[model samples]
Target chain A: MMKQSNLLAIVTCALGLAALSPSAMAEQLLEQQCASCHALQAEDYASSTVQERAERKAPPLYYAGNKFRPEWLVQWLQKPERIRPAGYFPAAHTVPGPDGDVVDSDSLPEHISLSAADAELASAALMKLTPYTDKLDAVDYEVGNISWRMGNLNFGKFNGCDACHRDAPDYGGLSGPELYSAWDRLQPKFIASFITDPVAWDPHTLMPANDLNQAAVQKLSDYLKVNGEDE
Target chain B: MRYALVTLAVSALTAVSAHSWAADAEAGKQLYQIYCTQCHGINGDGKGINIPDMSVLPRDHTDTSEMSARSDEELIKAIKHGGKAVNKSVLMPAWDKNLSDEQVDDLVAYLRHICCDK
Candidate 1:
């Protein structure tokens, strides 16, 4: 009976330690690396003005949990892309205000590279973030006659969207990636980030900085999100 | 009696023409909302989501100076063949395959209504 009791205690202790493992590793990564660029928790993130300012340069991690697909996040952290071809700032000299500013402050440190283990831990912790209540529904915009034809026309002539993106008619410019299927590929918030501030994704893009009023941004995002349906 | 009959006939023709034009205009509005609203915006203000990331800002459909410079044929060609046909960005795809000639006409009429205050 005593042996069995000891065995139960050992199993309880092992289980408890195992449960603590993820949090402990996540805590270390947050303190050692991620805290410099992101806010890991909701309470601290809400209270943190410094972190908010830092976020002006990089995407905020508080919502990372809700925003990213785990597989995609892991891949992206391994090799970051210039999602915004334009530099993160519309202008180099000005410190961007939060409303439409996409630029991160120059004072913030450059992106730090991570080891494989660190990347996995950071991604795991980051994916635990859920900052926003709303989630975008992925519906195929190309299915209906009105949306499909209209979306096609808008992609072609009325807007001149094909200029920088390669998939358009002449495939003339290289300023932006071929957006032939960006809608099916990218996350909604990531797309929203571009709408909010083109420079935030890329500070050096040749693309002009558009001043999109809020409502227009939402509509455009809605349209783009559905543009490249399943593929 | 003959004069009265002629007047009635002319009036009926005019009414029929007006009704047709109205139908075209209505169709145009629906088309505009479905496609043009994204970049040109609901009000044709040149503020769309992709607008910010573009190398050249979208044309403000409401700008009289810009619109006045463009002929209806030019607009049609631009819409059909894309901006590159006119030495502009190829970012605008050619909609020849997507919109029928009649639909294009309807869209043009809609553009006139929204941008020219007609």
Candidate 2:
């Protein structure tokens, strides 16, 4: 009876050991693959010089927990796609042509991919990396609606956000990331607040702090969500 | 009489070219309203919606004193290539990948009409 009980205890311990926690796997994967290219600890690229930040291989993932949805992060890790067609500050990174024009020659390398299980682990791990948890928690997020025609007009005409950002692939500006999937990939609260005062989020970010009231910012967020739905 | 006829012919030819040039500028004006007016301002005054928030103010396109100093070649290159191509601000993204050569030239013409024309 004593031997059987000991054997059962050992089996339970072994099973627990074999099940490597998602946090452990995440830390390992992040250190092994992501940390090599990404500044996982900091979002101070905004403070760095233009030339300094432009050389980065990837955007900082320190704020990923606050910026991205867990589902989107998991799917993206499994099947990575190009987000920023132009690198961060494309002007500083790409070599210019003899005609003194910048061609879209330089772009970011392909994002790293992970297996389904690994992606899930990484996603869980990343979702827990919330340095801004207190601040983010304070935000009051609500699903809302905005006028479709007015939203389009604001993006292209009033705000000129489309000048640098794309609504979808093959449309809008080439500089910023595509916003068609923004609703899925990003938190709406982050989007509206970031644009309201960009410097509040990223001091050296090239995106001009747009002169938009609170209502406009919310409407813009709603527009992005609606636009993503259509696609 | 032959000299008078030659003068008339030259004037007509010049008028035809000028008319074509006007159409190009007109097309450029439409493009500007669509793409640039928001940043450069409706009257090309560089006081768009983002003006208050910008640290470095956008170039006032209507500033004849500055625009007159730059040649057409320089202006066209800046428009098509971006600011960093000419060692200017990196805030200006290149447009050549999206715009054709003719469209760039037209934008340059429109800039001239707005900023440099007496």
lDDT to native, each model:
0.56, 0.69
Interface RMSD of 2: 13.7
Model 2 chain B poorest ten-residue lDDT run: B47-56
Tens-place lDDT digits, model 2, residues A36-66: 7777786555365333444566776777788
DockQ of 1: 0.05
Question: What lDDT tens digits, residue by residue, belong to model 1 across residues A1-231?
Answer: 579989999999998877877768787777787776554544443353222331344445676765566766666667665443323322221232332223244532446667677778888887666555343333222222225556555544545545445343234233344454455445666565554554333232233334445554555556565555523
lDDT of 1: 0.56
Pick the TM-score winner.
2
Candidate 2 clashes between residue pairs 3 or more apart in a chain or in different chains: none
* Cα error of candidate 1 at position B14, Å: 61
- State model 2's lDDT: 0.69
TM-scores of chain B alone in all candidate structures, in the order given: 0.83, 0.91
| Model 2 interface DockQ | 0.02
Model 1: chain A TM-score against the true structure: 0.48
